[model samples]
Target: MHDVTSQAGFASPDLSAFCRLDELGLVAVGQRLEPDRAVLACRVVEPDQWCRRCGCEGVPRDTVTRRLAHEPFGWRPTSLEVIVRRYRCSGCGHVWRQGTSLAAEPRAKLSRRGLRWALEAIVVQHLSVARVAEGLGVAWDTANDAVLAEGRRVLIGDRARFDGVAAIGVDEHVWRHTRRGDKYVTVIIDLTAVRAGTGPARLLDMVAGRSKQAFKTWLADRDEAWRDGIEVVAMDGFTGFKTAAAEELPGAVAVMDPFYADVLVMPMSVVFALLRGLSGAVRSA
Candidate 1:
């Protein structure tokens, strides 16, 4: 049998690149494929030489194995088993372990790539939570929590997401069916793309309730420049939304959304006639 340490010694550079461990200071020493999953064993490329406190040469004391879920490949869920070596200074008795931040966040179960894949799979590909969980080889709640946390950190928490807003839409949505938590949420959407004929509307934020205070407080968090850029606010029949917009963004034009306005003004006969005309036009096209 070949020594595990020497397995990736002559592995192709392409393979190393595909594994994406060089930047993390890890080299794949072994790989195993199972019927349902794959595992890539990695070791720190550079050994620790000196202690941080005393600047004395250190010796290897022990190693701890860290297993992280990696992005799936070849329809098989993949995992990375990294052997993190701990060093102890004989002079100062100081101890440290190999840094693995490049691979993942501290105490994170999934690698950065794995988290990003799960997020994109759900947001862009519209895959269900159960499907994403199976792809990552994790429990349903695990995948759900990780993906949601990542989304909040990367997308929702970022201040840049609120920029370039010219129009917005607000409505109340049933957030959670369970009685354990808040059942309703105020959903905010960026209608800039929809108004410009560029693409579908993008979700901007979600507040706790449909109350005027909730929406007003959310708007108050933004800077005056961002608030000034808002030209229009479209909402359903809810008067609270209008009140919130009027209070927070007095200059913005508040309009009834097409669906709600049609209901409020146009009779059913006219609505049916319009729908029939649209259908006939579609068939003609």
Candidate 2:
């Protein structure tokens, strides 16, 4: 036989090297790029899957292909046609499908990376939900739901975000500016980093109404450690907020924000000073 081993080095190009699916525990077996879209055929790298109940090794039974939306590649929306293998445990006779970390929770149409990309596009790039949906090749509701769920899970649900909070700012925001009704919300902001000159402030939470009860309830919900860590609370000239802070955060120093004080108090002080000076000048003249 003519040395067939020499041809091994001249084999076809490896698509996995370019696709970088290995980071998600997946391998690109094939690819098809078109003018409008691109499809990547992939398979999980895990050869051995265990039974859910028995914890025994599973044997391959068959494979089913599923199409999932992935992040766009060079302005073209990419889709992954993954071949998931069904397995049956030889010891316990249980059946299950191979799982990979490429996608979010099971049965989700969007991949984890796609969800992340959509969130960044909305929050950082300031893109609308419709535009993000269009870019991801998904419906508006699909994109909105995925982004909201992921944001809550990754950012809002993280309890560690409340840590290191030393200072806070509370104010009332007009949520609805219609003539029908005045709907206001109590907005709490973390001003620790801003006070320390380390980073910009971050929003802590928002309650439905602008009342002492609302603010007090929110403060009461926090753990003692978090409540104890609060040192300063900057707020507008709202007596309800001041009362709430006094009751809930006894050790915290409540102060009026400079903007409100300057606007409401400084102007009158300046006018009074000017009138007194003019009166004295009139008497002298």
Candidate 3:
């Protein structure tokens, strides 16, 4: 719980912004929270958009419905009541109840605000799903699902915006629980000058595997225009990525830089030993 002093109130400075009423097609009807601030309630309405049926636009019908639950609203850590509507499409015989306009998907347990908060926890705070759930007072499954959904959204959104990328860096990371084996996630980084320094190094838009089909699909998904702009691809001598890069970006230069090994100066067998020694020293200290 947060304290409401003269300087700060229960209502967050960005509360209105988080609601994104205009974006959601709703105006903030009202807000209610006790002085102690145990809970905060908000009401939302559907906005004017095309019909889910015949694509005809709609106005607010007289009929309204009330939905109750905890909806994420940024880091305010409060609940929400998303009130929806019953819309009658003019173009077709469709009479359907409209869903929440704020969330990307209807009936999403996590609101857009909650999704942002959880993503911040994973990407910025570097907190695991279990820890985030404990802190946010949500179930572990809920937090984990939110993270996965948001991760996919980020990967898709960022990839869609990439254009005229001159260079790319590809790498792999292990992402399985309680496994020391071969499960991996392939991440494609935009090595373009504009995307330098921890920019868009998340998972690429593809299925995770070291197989030829996985890499091929990733390459095939890219626009042919991307191949023309790509000048170079730097990878850690992985034959799979190397092959894919060559086949997909025929014009691009492929550099199998051993520097990607992190300790290219040493043999692969000795690198693990070195890492263990470093970990042991840190633990002892």
Candidate 4:
């Protein structure tokens, strides 16, 4: 149990700005901070004007608290406790709760801002799923499921992501270190923007397997016109990837990725240096 100072009067600043409650049609009314979490009490700024069914005035009946995980504030997990007022229509007696869809999806655990932050942390910052879960103050499975679903819905599901592509790079990744399933996954990256000096490279797709058949099959599935548009294929020295590019895209120029090229050169450089030293006689001859 908290007294007045700990419950209602401790927060001296307008927390609405910190969490951007204004964007969600909410205003902070009170705050309570635990040693590890910050809890903000909020109320909806705009209640429904009338009942949707009867178009008559609604009389407030009761209130319910809706809990949502918000973006962390200064490394402390923050949550919003929204005070939602339920109403009953005068004419039809229909009941409804205040609108809060902007804050989150219906029954979603993470706020819209929180969801966006989690997605960016995973895709742009390259943070792992566990880190995202810790930042959101949610379970690991919950964070992973939500982020993957939202990522697919927002990015992978978009039809226009493949447009204007001219260059691609294929590589194998150790997707999982554990021993249960296939550990290697093939990642296809679009280097068109990099080649054209427009922007950084972007991910085009990912498929299972690390063989020539995997790369060739993925290329074959694309529209022939789209495949024809590729002007360059960059990859490591792995003949499997090189063979796939040659067979599927004969017209595209093949080039070694700079990072792999350095790896390949250092060994050759050492071998040649040792040969040159093997016989000061060899050079003199």
Pick by lDDT: which candidate is best? 4
**Model 4 residue pairs with clashes:** none
Model 3 lDDT tens row, 123-234: 6555556655654556666666665666656655575547656776666644443345546556565556524544433233434666655776887877788777888777
lDDT of 2 at 253: 96
lDDT of 4 at 258: 75
> Mind giving the per-residue lDDT tens digits that candidate 1 earns over 1-285?
765655756653454468676766678888998888999898878787689899998899999999988888765898899999999998999999888887888888888878878876765565666777788888776777777677667746877768799988877765454556666677777778777778656567767767888999998998899999999888887888899899899999998857433332322222222222222121211
For all predicted structures, in order, the TM-scores are: 0.74, 0.76, 0.60, 0.76
lDDT of 4: 0.76
Local distance difference test scores for all models:
0.74, 0.73, 0.55, 0.76
- Candidate 2, overall lDDT? 0.73
lDDT string for model 2 (24-80, tens) is: 667888889877789999998886588888898888899999777788867578888
Which scores better on lDDT, 1 or 3? 1
Give me the displacement of residue 9 in model 1, in angstroms: 23
Model 4 bad stretches (over 4 Å): 1-13, 49-61, 87-94, 123-127, 257-285
TM-score of 4: 0.76
- Those runs of model 1 whose alpha carbons end farther than 4 Å from true positions after fitting are 1-13, 22-25, 46-50, 54-57, 191-202, 256-285
